[model samples]
Target: MATVLVIGASRGIGLELVRQYRAAGDRVIATARDDEGMTRLRELGAEPLRIDVAQPASVSGLAWQLDGEEIDVALYVAGVIDRGHATTPPTQSAFDHVMHTNVLGLMQVLPQVMPMVEATGGVFGALSSSMSQIGPVPGSNSWLYRVSKAALNMAVRSARFDYPKARLVVLDPGWVQTDMGGESAPVTVEDSVYGLRRVLASLGADDNGCLIHHDGRRAASW
Candidate 1:
């Protein structure tokens, strides 16, 4: 069975991924920041790790936790959103909180995990958003969130050069029904994860460093 790692799996897309991967009989090592989230992962048959990606000290211990295993799939799914638009300036604390969780956290995790992925010629997927696209500007409702995901997209693509053995790609999961997506979202969590898994499974060397949509389409532009 493939060994999968899902970071920030407390709820939403991350948690659903753990559930589906475990159901497929893959060995899953999933992370969350609290006891409650740990319990949920355990119930779903995942090897749970406590990881607060927002805190550097907490993330620093990840390498030791997964020292020798070859990971087939590693996903960086931790992120926080900011709803404030460009009409008003975000406070320093707001910017830091969003950037630290969305961009900095993944940057810290990559060094610890990419080697494990490389050992198996694995796929490393980071959850990004189509809203992050700059070519066709979307609405400015969540401008800070847009900026952070755009940065995340760049971070994964740039890091792909260093770990050539691993297929690194950013995933846009679409607007799903979750706490973050709220009640009006059209996509379901199950559908999004299913499509993401299909896309990841089909990735080849040529697809590396690309942004993939949930429906398995490679993005034409950023």
Candidate 2:
């Protein structure tokens, strides 16, 4: 069995990933920002680690906590969508928060956690969105979110060279039905995660730095 780490495991896709991983007999280290989330993760048999990805110190603390452990699959699933409507510009505060959490936060945590995964010759992945693409944009809504996720994709791709021993990729879980994806999203979290698990299991050295969709077979445009 592999030791998997799911960052931002409080709810939605993150929470479901923890559940599925644990149910599959993997040792999971799940992180959340709140006590409630921690409690729920524990109920599902995950070892909870409290973290606020927007804060560098919390990410550092997690690195310290896992200093000697070997991680097989480290998936960073924490992210936020733009709160403002498509027709209007997003507030400065919302933009800043999204950029910090979705982009800067991943960059900060990558350096700290990647070494652990690399030690085991494993893989690292971050949840990126297909909407991040520029050519023939999928939707005009959540412009800030789109921008932030695009930046996130670039960050992960660029960082791949720095961690040569571990395979790193950006994953688009598809428009999964989560709190972020909303009710109308076409893909259910279960279906997304199921395929995502297959995608993760199938990743190899050559697949490093790719942007992949949840179908486990297709590559997403950068």
Provide the lowest-lDDT 10-residue window in model 2.
213-222
lDDT of each: 0.94, 0.89
Quote the lDDT for 163 in model 1.
Answer: 98
The digit string of per-residue lDDT tens for model 2 on 1-222 reads 999999999999999999999999999999999999999999999999999988777777877878788999999999998755578987888887898889888998898889998899999999998888787696677889889998998999899999999999989899989999889999999999988899999987779998889997556356
Candidate 1, residues 66-130, lDDT tens digits: the string is: 98989999999998898998899999999998998999899999999999999999999999999
TM-score of every prediction relative to native: 0.98, 0.95
Residue 214's lDDT within candidate 2 is: 92
Query: Which parts of model 2 are misplaced by more than 4 Å?
Result: 83-87
